[model samples]
Target: MLHLENLSFSVHNNGDSKQIISDINLDIKRGKLYGITGPNGGGKTTLAKVIMGILTHTAGHIYLDGEDISDKNITERANLGIAYAFQQPPRFKGLTVEDLVKIAQPKLSNLSVRKRMRDVGLCPEDYLDRDMGSGLSGGEMKRIEILQVLARNAKLAIFDEPEAGVDLWTIQRLVDIIVGKYQNNPEAAAVLITHNRNILPICDEIVVIEEGRIKHHGHRDEIWPIIRDDIVCQVQDTCRGEEII
Candidate 1:
């Protein structure tokens, strides 16, 4: 559903260019969920942002369904069936949960909107009318973040650390929602930027991005040992409580 060709992004600081992502050639197929993980400052989030047009690529082309969207802006990409859920969700002081839901999917009935909230482990009575600002916890805001993304029903969804601050119940529901999105749709796919072990095993493919480039990319079973390595699980987050770090 999405193709990234020779993609690269760099930033200029003190007249020196520092590369964040370089020569990332990837094909994200429809009906598949891709898991992306790596160390900090590894360009994972930057690559995702570049795809969403939040950051302009220094070089290379981004194609969605065979059309070049490299030059498109954030709104344009979103309108073209792309959705992104941030690692750190944004704050909107005045907008209630219902308001944001309406903005994402105006056609959803009030009942449907509330149902989505419940799907994310949020109680409608307590959160439907609550402000999306300081009053809401990080986990709450993250749930709402995924809620809006899921509401868009985008062809390609990019989730940057969707499991960051949520409880187990919400994470489980999130896995269900994400996996269900492209399971039967031949035209939908997802890119998950995460380290949660609960999410990695189910992915059709796993990608490891390190030092501004893809270090390893392959089927899950082929790369599981490479990721686990020795003691530590190598992954930062705890995984199934068996050999958690």
Candidate 2:
């Protein structure tokens, strides 16, 4: 369970201030798969980073399991069972898949490493011994990053565009892993930041962000139609374009 109250963030650009997020308040329930969707630069990723304490917020509070975590550092938040997977996953220069998995779960053996890779739709034989560096492709890095998240068994997982750069085949597998693996686990909850419609169906709730603010939050069925209508209306009116106002 996570709650963000009256959150706001801004940055200085060429001596001018630019607000990235404003008055964002949201509550994510346990064992639920929540989707954060919106047009580009809507602050969805920023909100994720704020919750993970990677980016310092200019205002408001963040609560994890009812306690305030706005002041916590990334390691502190991670120790509190909050995990974040970035849009562009970082490369580990010297680590191998086996090494990374071992780091996440020390008790896991080689067999478990293979199993975990299989679970994430990767070939254990191909990836288990591969270097987690430039040798691997972006998609491979992404999958490995996700595998690490799963291996950590964190209480709260924030995935920023988990489907990005992954092929359709892997995307389906990733979706299945998120829904079938984590969504059903009562011990953890997930927040998926993506614009992909393929993931919407499995989400328990869909939260739409626009211009750094939460514009809509509800069940998928309840919010999808509204989003669909809004898209149609915007396309019909060329002046509005695709901006989620």
Candidate 3:
């Protein structure tokens, strides 16, 4: 289990300190998926980075399975079975998909690599030898990055915007793979930060953050109705803008 006790973060913007995350408290248990969704600039990503130790919290404690990890660095946290997937995955000019996977888990075998590719809905022969560069589209790169995290077999995984820039079919496949693999592991947990409505359906619980505070959080069935209405409003606004253009 992962626990955040009154976690908070602040940063210097224009030489003035501004709080990005308020006194946020959350508990994440293994075998469950926790979805974080909200409008942009709501500190959702900041919270994930704090949990991953990418940014040191100004106050509060972070505990993993009863161990105090609040002061640990990003590498230390990763060594403790915590993994994070970036919103925009980085590209490696000379690295093949197989090579990257090997680096993630040196003990992974050729057969396992093929299986991982297939798990993410990619054909082994078609992607294993492909370079992790511009040749791969945003969606392909996201899937490959996810495959690397899966190979790590981390106890807790944080994925930021996993469905961004992907088509509906691809998003569906990715969400299924993520929820299936992560939620099925009795000793692992997943935290997904996304604005995609489709991904929310698979979550065990949803946390809605607004203006650096948690506006609402509860079981999927309980929270969906309120959030669904908000999402509908946003979509309608977007459509209106498109029509105007």
Candidate 4:
């Protein structure tokens, strides 16, 4: 389980402190998938970074199971079975897909690598030797990033905008991969930071954040109806400016 108590993060912007995440609290359980959804710039990504130790929280405690990891760095958190898939997965100019996956899990076998590639709807023969640079599409990069995380089999995994820049078919495939992996591992947990309504139904819980604060958090059945209604309203009243991804 992961528990965050009054967690907050602030940064100095021109000598004035700006809070990106403020006094947030959450409890995420193992063997479940948790969905975090909100408008862009609502601090959903920042909160994920704090939990993954990519950003140090200015206040409060982060506990994984019963261990306090508030002061841990990104690498330390990763070593403790916490993994994060970034909104924009980094490009490795000189590495092939297989090379990068091997680096992510050095002990991973070729067969396992191929299987993961296939699971993400990529042909291993076509992609295993492909460079991890501009050659791949946004959807490809996202899947490869997800494959790396799944290969790690981390106890807690966080994926930021997993459905971004993908078509409907690709989104469904990505959802299947994420949900299947989490469902298969009873000791592991997943946090998905997504605006895609398709991903919400698979979650055990839904957390809604706005302006750096959680507006609602509860079981999926209880919270999703409200969220779904909001989405419908937003669509009906839309007139531009980045519709939810």
lDDT of each: 0.90, 0.87, 0.90, 0.89
lDDT, candidate 1, 70-162, per-residue tens: 889999999999999999999998899999999999999999998999999999999999998678999999999999999999999989999
> Which prediction has more favorable TM-score, 1 or 3?
1
Rank by lDDT (best first): 1, 3, 4, 2
Question: Considering only N, C-alpha and C atoms within 3 Å, which residue pairs clash in candidate 2?
Answer: none
Off by over 4 Å in 2: 235-245
TM-score for each predicted model, relative to the true structure: 0.93, 0.92, 0.90, 0.93
lDDT (tens digit, per residue) of candidate 4 on 78-172: 99999998899999998999998898898888898898888878899899999997799988998889888878889999999988876677778
**Candidate 4: minimum summed lDDT over ten consecutive residues — where?**
236-245
Residue-level lDDT for 46 in candidate 4: 92
- The regions of model 1 sitting more than 4 angstroms off are 230-245
Q: Candidate 3 lDDT (Cα, whole model)?
A: 0.90
Better of 3 and 4 by TM-score: 4
Model 4, residue 90: displacement in angstroms? 0.9
Worst 10 residues of 2 by lDDT: 234-243
- Report the C-alpha displacement of residue 206, candidate 1, in angstroms: 0.6
- The model with the greater lDDT, 1 or 4, is 1
Give the Cα error of residue 60 in candidate 3, in Å: 1.3
**Distance from true location, Cα of 1 in model 4, Å:** 1.1
- lDDT of candidate 2 vs native? 0.87
